[model samples]
Target: MSVDREPGLRERKKERTRRAISDVAMRLFADRGFDNVTVAEVAEAAEVSLSTVFNYFPTKEDIFFDRQEDVEQEWGEVVRGRKPGESAVAALRRHYFEALERREPRSGIAEGLVTFHRMIEESPALRAREREIGERGVEALARTLAEEAGADPDDITPRVVANQVAGVYGALYNEGRRRLLAGQSVEEAYPFLLRAARRAFDLLENGVGDYCIRPG
Candidate 1:
């Protein structure tokens, strides 16, 4: 019988190297602006070769948005891991509330003073990239919903419900950013987002029962 060995020191070192590169890149982007910072600078600051940096992060933007893939993965997990009788929307609603309670960074109510928020708002490229990420999230959620409902890929119900759910999150995210830009504290933003989220999900629970409400 072959025993699977745990990741060796070399593998651990590689992971640390990748994280260091990403950390250096994000720091530079936050301080000097994303577009202004070159890959060479990031490589030098990270103490790695330019090719090594690219090996970890294919694009400069990937450095700044390192958490993007995690977001997609978590969305699927929320849907797939819902309680036995829970609906997809219900699972997401619970997840959002839990994040809010913990003030998780993904909740958008994290310290309203995050510099990354300002960076993204200031960079059109990053903003456009964010929209693309949102689209991907919608597509992912749609696919998951279709599978859960055993519907065809082209079915309108899952796509429409996915869009509605994604829209709620997108709106809440932007509203948090707007409030922060307007100088509102996270404390100030919290209640507003909670209220808005409740209303949005309530609408989904009622208005689109056929699509969003779990069947008995």
Candidate 2:
């Protein structure tokens, strides 16, 4: 069957090749460990050349985190695209809940992700890579917040806000993963996740010793 999914045939072929390689790599990594598989093995198994693998994935970790850059961009956009007059904290809070409603894998609420999470847990290198990704997300959010406030490039407030937001996200994400991996279904998980997230964001909005006051 002649295909018309994307604009061009060449693009379709490229997508097929990328998916094929990714499927092979993930299967091998899941069968073996992430640290044990080399790019050459992945290429060979996928019937691609080593250079082709490097073309798509600069490192083996890149294969695991194929969407990391897109995710970082989304974090910045979440702050930048917040509704007019919305505080950064409010925008992030709304985004967090929306991700839950959509069952986003990044939110750690989606099913079928525990195996992938387990893979990361089993690899020291992947754990370090995940930390690096978190730091990058914080930096991107900080840059957007600084832009919004027209702050000096050296200002610490944006960085502080970014750290606070990132810390909240990291804690919530890990806790959610713990619950989900422990066999709680999405229906059983989100109520507690929402409650905990609300309290966490409340802490950010109204500092310690103060009640949360919704913005006018």
Candidate 3:
């Protein structure tokens, strides 16, 4: 999953080529627009053949989401690898805060992320694909939770929990992105995001049964 530790000449070259291609593709996409460019153009601009591009990325969207699988596994891995006595919500909370502390790009709260965000918003295809990826993430988390809880195949609790957890995270992430795209710098938004994240995760961990009442 990590290429930083990779050794040998061939592996290093392939990594460089992949990075070059991805970088070129993003730059082109950001400059003109995602829909305005084509893979062939990107290949020509990057000086790699179309086949070479395909060898690294399967689709145009793959060019944008170069680490799709890694990103998907990230949340599930946090839950799956949670320490003893750590709830899934707590594990995810810890993972998210770690990203916020480092301002990791995956958190979508990092600086310059709005450029890519704007591109995705402009492209319906990318928007649909991102939504699909979100659903896949939810399913992956649900499966992991089910396995951890030793739930019966017919049980829907894990799946339900997954949806709720994913929804909470999606909301928190969108809120962070909103603040950033509103022209707030990372330094300004991150503190507020951390507070928002803590509150959202707290609701998940503590339950929402009494969150709101009619006050009758």
Candidate 4:
């Protein structure tokens, strides 16, 4: 909800330090698994004090999911910043297509995506952390939709819509990861992903809106 501003020198420096620490942590996690990598080990690897590492990352899971806060807010941001005449589903569909075209990491089709996802799949703690982040994203999206529609607190429509959208998005993400884990290169898997995404979003837009209605 806050407006963006240019980072100051100190802020930039701090960001650099944070990124360095995270990069170090990720490499350790990749090489030795998340649970095997200790916070003190990460501090030693990154040449930062243990306290400094804790200052930036409250937990080992936090280090692994360093950008989760930004990720949790993304669905709300997409809806809030949609074009004047665009529906929320349409806005999300467009955003997802663009991210796919760009091969963005958030699109689940970036470089090292296989390794990144493999790390998550192998780590129970990371998997649980991922689920927590996903639930937060759904909550944020529901809250944003309710606010935009001026719905009362008791209205469940926004929450239902949010869950629907989140399920679709998660399926799309996992499909991409599944292809990569099956040994398909990004280029090899992209066309399939595009088709799948289009079908999924189209279903969200036109197929499910009136499904299984009971006759009065």
Instruction: Judge candidate 4 at residue 65 and give its lDDT.
Output: 96
lDDT of 3 by residue, 39-67 (tens): 99999999989999999999999999888
TM-score of each: 0.91, 0.87, 0.88, 0.91
lDDT of 3 at 112: 83
lDDT of 3 at 187: 89
Tens digits of per-residue lDDT for model 4 on 119-158?
9989999999999999999999999988876778998988
- In Å, residue 37's CA in model 1 sits off its true spot by 0.4
After superposing candidate 1, which stretches have Cα over 4 Å from the reference?
Answer: 1-8, 209-216
Q: Residues 48-126, candidate 1: write the lDDT tens digits.
A: 8999988988988888888888776677678888776678888888988898777777777687346878999888889
- Rank all candidate structures by their lDDT, best first, as comma-separated numbers: 4, 2, 3, 1
lDDT of 2 by residue, 49-127 (tens): 9999998889999899878898777777887777766788878888898887788887777877777887998999999
**Regarding lDDT, does 3 or 4 come out ahead?**
4
Candidate 4 colliding pairs: none
Candidate-wise lDDT, in order: 0.81, 0.83, 0.82, 0.87
Ranking by TM-score: 1, 4, 3, 2
Best by lDDT: 4
Q: Which prediction has more favorable lDDT, 1 or 4?
A: 4
